[model samples]
Target: MSSSLIFTFIFTLCLLSSCFSSSASLHNATDENVTLRPQHEIQKLKLIREHLQKINKPTVKTIQDPKHGHWWLQFGSGTLVGYWPVSLFTHLMEHGNMVQFGGEIVNTKPGGSHTSTQMGSGHFAGEGFGKASYFRNLEMVDWDNTLIPTANLRVLADHPNCYDIRGGVNRVWGNYFYYGGPGKNSKCP
Candidate 1:
């Protein structure tokens, strides 16, 4: 396996271990036959598990309930990254419907000219595996509360000449995609 992939797996395992260990410590039987978490902790780990299952259900439409707050984690390291809370938009009665993956950048050049910028590895998707930027083992949570390979995945490139994306699946990578390119190329400009 690639070093980067091994590192990612180790990092993810560490984060999950930490989360589980902390939450598990809070689970204890009380004399009154009720196990309760601290008041400061509004939503415990159970809530997170329930939310994950609920969101994956086909009948469920909302992604988040404002009543139960949510945070996105940027786990760069054990301490460097933190949780970022999201505020609901006015139009979103309950939560968001669409989820997007990938990168976006604006062309600030005047006269509709392309800028000499690079996206992921500074190579086009056509450059193939090791030469291009890619994402691998992509999966989505299912109603069964288990992770499943992404289905009906879509790929799009606003400026194909400047940047592009190609999707594929394999036993090793599962649902994977190679993307990105050098901007302001002869074909792009």
Candidate 2:
């Protein structure tokens, strides 16, 4: 075969192989993505079981009257994170003008490891503002063990006045876990 023809044939083969490899990779990625959540949930459930065993606490398989909302705040160590429901914020906003919300630290893991503490505060505009003005403030310990604080404000004119807020900070680690969606699927280990 002519030199140019041979070169063209080799290039075409290479291009075809590259396309097939990319297609296979994409397919595998999609499959893995779908399976990851279920697997993680199972692992978290197992961890919860183990934790109960260690503490000699009864396994409460389910929570009653879970909370559902749009906004949230979460923080944790390792795989265990905290969450706060938006509904509670709304409820507090409705009843009071300047509100300070705080939680106590309850548990720590990896014994002897320093446990980080967090705090959140918020406020709302007074009645007849015709709407609620919301603001949130957060504080945490930095890597250098120094305290760092931040704040944010948001205004929502369409908040419903009569929605229920559920869920509370876990007594174990001050981590807030939300509920009322998808059974026990939204839990952390």
Candidate 3:
């Protein structure tokens, strides 16, 4: 065979092999025995939701910049405690969905800037920075292997207790498995 033809054949083989490998990995990951079995996954998700029952759902005052739509959620009103660990935690998938949920709110619209509350247990809303990238057949977990973090009494004004979260971007996405921050005022060690 000509050298060019041989090179093309090798390249095609490599591409096909890589695609098969990726597909197999996805298959294995979704086998129900991957993260937690059906019952266990449900249990973990339920426990995470249960944490919200304890929260008072304090509606801290919100500030929005008129020009850029920069929103600042003020959480210094009181000592609100919950089970949200400032790290990776299990966000359950939608019923019968393939992709699991993470803590990412994206603004797909170009130049989109607005804060909207997410659909979940707690009151979570943030301003959009950029686009979002999602992973398939992945699960989010917490520090203790439970769901959310517990014993978290955050004082947002302290700056130490709060974390400056930024995501929905191309390069960066979500908690990134605890590499993000406990904020400047966080008591985490």
Each model's TM-score?
0.55, 0.17, 0.18
Give the worst 10-residue stretch by lDDT in candidate 3.
4-13
Q: Give the candidate order by descending TM-score.
A: 1, 3, 2
Per-candidate local distance difference test: 0.53, 0.25, 0.25
- Residue ranges of candidate 2 with Cα displaced over 4 Å: 1-48, 51-139, 146-165, 169-172, 183-189
Lowest summed lDDT window (length 10), candidate 1:
1-10
Strongest candidate by TM-score:
1
lDDT of 1 by residue, 47-147 (tens): 33343333221221112223444322322222224322344244333333444456555788887889877876568899985467666667543333344
Better model by TM-score: candidate 1 vs candidate 3: 1
Query: Which structure among the candidates has the greatest lDDT?
Result: 1
Per-residue CA lDDT of model 2 for 112-181, tens digit only, reads 5323321111112232111221112223333332333423322222221211112233335232221111
Backbone clashes, each candidate:
0, 1, 6
Stretches > 4 Å off in candidate 1:
1-68, 74-80, 86-96, 142-146
The TM-score that candidate 3 achieves is 0.18
Give lDDT tens digits, candidate 3, residues 57-140.
222322322333332334334323232221221222111112222243233434343323221222212322111111111222
Q: How many backbone clashes does candidate 2 have?
A: 1
